[model samples]
Target chain A: MLYLGYCRHCGAGLLGLRRCGQGHLLVLCDECDALWQTSDLGQPPQFPPQPDLPCPHCGQSLNGPTAHWASLDEVRQAGWNDALIVGPGGCSAASAT
Target chain B: MRPGRRSVGLTLLGFGVLLAWLVVKPMLPTGPVETGQVRPETPNAGPPASVERPDGAAEQAERPVERPIDSAAGALTELPGDVWRSPGGLLYGPGSREGHRLRHVLRHARDDPDRPGEHGVFDGDQAAIVALIDEAYARSEQGAGRVERDGPRSVVTVDLQRRVGYVGGQVGRRQGHPATRHVRLVLEGRNVITAYPLRP
Candidate 1:
């Protein structure tokens, strides 16, 4: 039940601010070496929009094509599709069903 | 001569005595019990109300209470399966029967939010995946049981116990038996979800 604010990529609790190559302060995760640059310090870094983005350290794909890597984006996409559909089982089921 | 007031008064007095005898008859003892006619013993009554309940029954009655769904969290809680809310505020469970049919899209839907309707795919979070699975399990259970949210694995697991009926083979032609069923569901907030029935 404890929410310790884990890093989404590596499940690590250590998130520190470091300067990226672009001279912007980026959030760095020590466990996976994932970095996120946010425009505002108060706001959380957005989910990476790039597909198949890899981890800087582990070389593992950060945002894969699958839902595992793209969960946040997937949910947001679902919201829009939900509105266009005439009913519940449309959207993804249209292709697979 | 016609009956006088004294005769009427005397008749009334006799009726009163008979009524009194009827009322007192049940409480009064008979002459004596017959030697051959023994009284039957009464069944022992249960213990008094103040007595403590048996530990097994007490524990069984004290199972954890299921919490209501959070309606504001989009379509995650709205799925049709059994739902478990982890202490970390993660909602998870298995997919419902109908939901299971949607596994094709559930497993392969791309996470392209920028393109939106072009992919004909819907984006989802771990909670959404959990909700889809949860909806599938709603028919099997009243609610999710033994929920776990593993941060390291980034997964949610729920264990459930159920009673299922089975038909016997040649020997069971005449009868059916019920067996206790146990199932475990594992979800990594993605398409890597799986469920297996356990030996009870």
Candidate 2:
């Protein structure tokens, strides 16, 4: 868990942050789940890690700046809703809930 | 003054009392755990000890005796056939922790990410625990949540309990189920293969 200082949303001291199902960095107050949303990504990337995945839309391997998949907001802003965003296959979560 | 007036007045009084009780109930929390729900005890936190035992000839015997019979022998056999018999949860590997924590964090009345192959890498047991969780929530198409691997093995420790028990990091749906579903698959270690049900 990377220390990200205080949560901007809750003002609670943040010891860490994680990506929620929606691809948002969910800042957690783990004891009580006073969740905070932050735009500032923290401590670079570590843990299970950001995969070197390909964009289902561009059909090209994600590299350099595009390593992580774009959020729904970014996708929409780019007018790429119709693009086929691929799951993180191989490392993709198989249990599709 | 009339008989009908008295009857109506009594009915109104009862309704007022019922409404007042509803507003008051929120303030009266009996304890942290709800009344009907079972309270999950933190394995470490139990009866408070008033004083530390004095070091003496008695300490040797007392310490050994104080330890639970099941735990003292944990090092000998980590994956016993019936692990459910133990009271405390085991330490799960990073992989299993990610697998279990992933779903519990994601699946909600929110954006539903589909969990696939939950049975494979999802938390359950050091052996085939992921396969078990997957089978339980095999209906991944439900758009509940996703399961991801954090390490090589499903490292969650499990304890034998009546309620769903946590394996390394996730709970196994297999230990007990009125209905059981099994699937055949090839996993990490070829020597450690087994058919785990979709649900316990």
Candidate 3:
């Protein structure tokens, strides 16, 4: 699966970007369910990321989740479609790396 | 007239009377009508404000005032169904993308080793959860909650001040976290992204 970044807190779940209704971008961790608002869509969230934000749905602190990587389909189904990787070569690069 | 013609004529007359009665009944006064009653003239009285009864009592006649209907309360009534359109024009149901989002929410319903802390877990079935989401959406639309922009989505939060669910993630259940009284609803344009109980 093409990953934008990894969860800063758990360092396990892959991170991706999702756009809100107003076109603002947010970083989402598929495994831990942590979400963060970001100014840049090109760069994924980095470690020591903003304070421990709660999951918007469950309101749980976004600091947990074991080494479980979410499937690409699950991430896409959850509205995380704005991956940093682009084009046909990007897919191969994501797979190669 | 022939007997058959006479019977038909009678039936038509009866039907006309019944129709007239139906139309006139609503216009008729519900209270007793006063007829042929006279009151003694009092000196310097320009007009009689009330009618005096034979027993020397005065009856005040006035139309009863009607109370205004509360439309908001009427809209908040529990509507039957698993799906509902929020006041803000969002469609929420299992048929929409909300189904996928709900899967993530249901994950917090139990204690999972991978997810820790007191995650707000819902305490009811899918129907009940949908109802809660409907209510929260309504409240948020009425400006009784918070709405924050998240790109192409909006996160709405409402505090119902009553136990709508419980906190029961891995460490939360062991710590005996209290029930949640708030709801967080996320919407993408006119579609519901997800909704779930919020930590108190």
Candidate 4:
């Protein structure tokens, strides 16, 4: 339930549909990561952060929100599309912050 | 005066004159390089009698022109996912922002009225295609593009910066839905003469 504020891609706060490496809204987000691909799980889930993953395409550090934990294949597959992260359990009160 | 000494004195005098000439020449400013009054270089290899003739190499065995080292070097002749023809530019969707961007991307390229338009979705697979078009558009600041239907899907071709460019595949619906058509852009000359779109 921990509130993770990150731009999903650059770990930078969402830049209103952030421009990917190609300077286009390849993957964008609004109102937090809400505009990003939304996860379908009714409850929020918890995932560990891997701060070491740098995007191969743009060398941007990847240590942000749960959705930011995407691999190159996944990112490439979802060109300009936001990542959807839904967990089974609801966001814990402590994590919701 | 001894004849042998006189001869030796004359030799010394000549040497001194030559030394003085060398020293004065070094002190004087040298003029422009005059290669024998600028003769015309011809495979005819003969020196031209006239110095006034234009020396431009108009007729000569030419070497094959090499591509630019920055990008034209090791250029990709063809890509796998292609859908449309364009001069090379940005690919925008049907939305207003995207539309404006589309217009911006198309400013440099010309359209191929003869080639019928096709449509396809901008699937992630076609990112390369979009990237290619964007590159071209960036180069020319203008491009030609079109939107069409590929079967039940849709596709778009943005030719912005070059001549004889193309993109292919299907693109359907807007975001929130999975993009379908494969997008691509091929390079050509300074303008876009034609484009071809592929269907899903």
Candidate 5:
């Protein structure tokens, strides 16, 4: 399903959540040239390279997995919880109640 | 034959009685009369207000008062659904995650500029309730966002950022990072009962 929200990096008020071919969720921030996995099941899903799209924050072209995938460890290191990638399927790390 | 004196006297007495009756009618007490259609007691106009009764008792009376919008809004436990594990700062349900109504609410607020205090959920407005789960992850960083049940309603409060404020009496600390742009949401089942933003 497509979910819309804000892009913190560029403060753009839209972001979309879509599943790639492998059934993994991906979040693409077009304004920021950022595409990342919402799920961490396998290697983060790859999107077709967009050489023309430049990261709004750093002006880096988002063309490969190295530049686009948000590692699960990196997210955790940044102080984020594990719910994003786990989907609703059942991630036991945190309970929202 | 001319009217006898007795007949004329009797006629004068009857006229006097009629005049007396007219004068006294207005003076009589007209007790409360029931209208067959009882005006349904106008439902309390607004929030109940505290009023002083003649017996020196405090009572709740219906009055139009601008109820001070509470910064805390309402409790969370009132929401329809059983407590479920809060996953990734988003509270999920008595049912499956997709079926959880609150998921749409938090997502909608991510882009919604207008902070509607309390709102009802309509089928057509489901778009207003969608939030990107990825971004929700970023916002909940540093324990800044939280979702929990307050009563029957679910309360979701998120602190947008950490702020620096000067402290006065702390023996060792001179400054502290305060939470800023805190948004509290009170939800009932599938609807947003009220969303309050409180900054400390």
Candidate 6:
């Protein structure tokens, strides 16, 4: 899977960034469906976190056990190789240069 | 004038009149002409207008002419199979990273890492999975599913309420993952990010 990081709470969950219709950048967990809002791409969660958005997969409350942001560096430290970049057109492979 | 000369003159006059009529006949409007109706400059310029054919049948001018499905050589005129092609070449050939994304999603068709025993698995082959994704995308385009934005990508989630595949993942194998009635597909833009069975 092309992932940005692994969920800190649930070690098995794969974490990726998703944008909501209102232009909110949300950190999402594929395994647990947890969610966290962030103001910037690949950055930590914003302070005074926004209200929890519904999980896109299950349509349930996104505030699960692993509802926190994990930066790219932390993801690399965790040994998840081939991490994708959060760009204007969603996740993409880093340029060779 | 002499009689013969007079007869020749009358005959000449008759021929002249016939020639005049031939030239003027085309200039004169034939049949009932509609005063305000203007002919379209282009074939598809306006709405369909009913026009009488030489066989006296009224046909819509806007209707496109139908063509035969087979060629004169008895070969199919169109290519076989679905017209849509995977932009990343996952299904066709010359594979790319998109294939990896597809495989990751298909993994759930066999096993759910989080809730291994509880979730079901998809039953069909890669083609079936791709077809389901295509259908979900169609429905999503028609506003049948939930649509969200992930960066510049569009994330569409569609729930197909039918038995798409049987349970056969790592955990479901012990229980003999039976046919599931509902399936959910998560698509990023036109690519299917992931798809798996959901408990009904």
List runs of model 3 lying over 4 Å from the truth: A1-27, A31-97, B1-89, B92-99, B108-114
| DockQ, candidate no. 4 | 0.01
TM-score of 5: 0.19
How big is the positional error of residue B174 in model 5, measured in Å on the Cα after superposition? 19
- What is the Å distance of residue B85 in model 1 from its true position? 16
Candidate 4, B1-111: lDDT as tens digits: 899999999999999999999889988988775321222112123332212112211111111121111112112222222212223422222111111212212211222
Clashing pairs in 3: A19-B152, A20-B151, A20-B152, A20-B153, A21-B151, A21-B152, A21-B153, A22-B152, A23-B151, A24-B151
lDDT of 3 by residue, A35-62 (tens): 5555243453332222233334444323
Give the alpha-carbon lDDT of every model: 0.32, 0.27, 0.46, 0.28, 0.33, 0.42
The digit string of per-residue lDDT tens for model 6 on A22-83 reads 22345665543345553233453221111234444444333332322333444344444433
TM-score for each candidate, following the candidate numbering: 0.19, 0.20, 0.40, 0.16, 0.19, 0.34
Each candidate's fnat = 0.00, 0.00, 0.00, 0.00, 0.00, 0.00
Off by over 4 Å in 5: A1-97, B1-144, B160-180
Between candidates 5 and 6, the TM-score winner: 6
Each prediction's number of clashing residue pairs: 19, 34, 10, 58, 22, 3
* Most accurate candidate by lDDT: 3
Every candidate's chain B TM-score = 0.21, 0.23, 0.48, 0.20, 0.23, 0.39
lDDT tens digits by residue: candidate 1, B1-200? 35798898889999999999999999998886433212211112222111113111121222212222333332333334544353333344433111221221222122222211111112243334334445435522454554445442222323333332122222123323223243334434532234322222
Model 5 chain A, TM-score vs. native: 0.35
**Better by TM-score, candidate 3 or 2:** 3
Candidate number achieving the greatest TM-score relative to the actual structure: 3
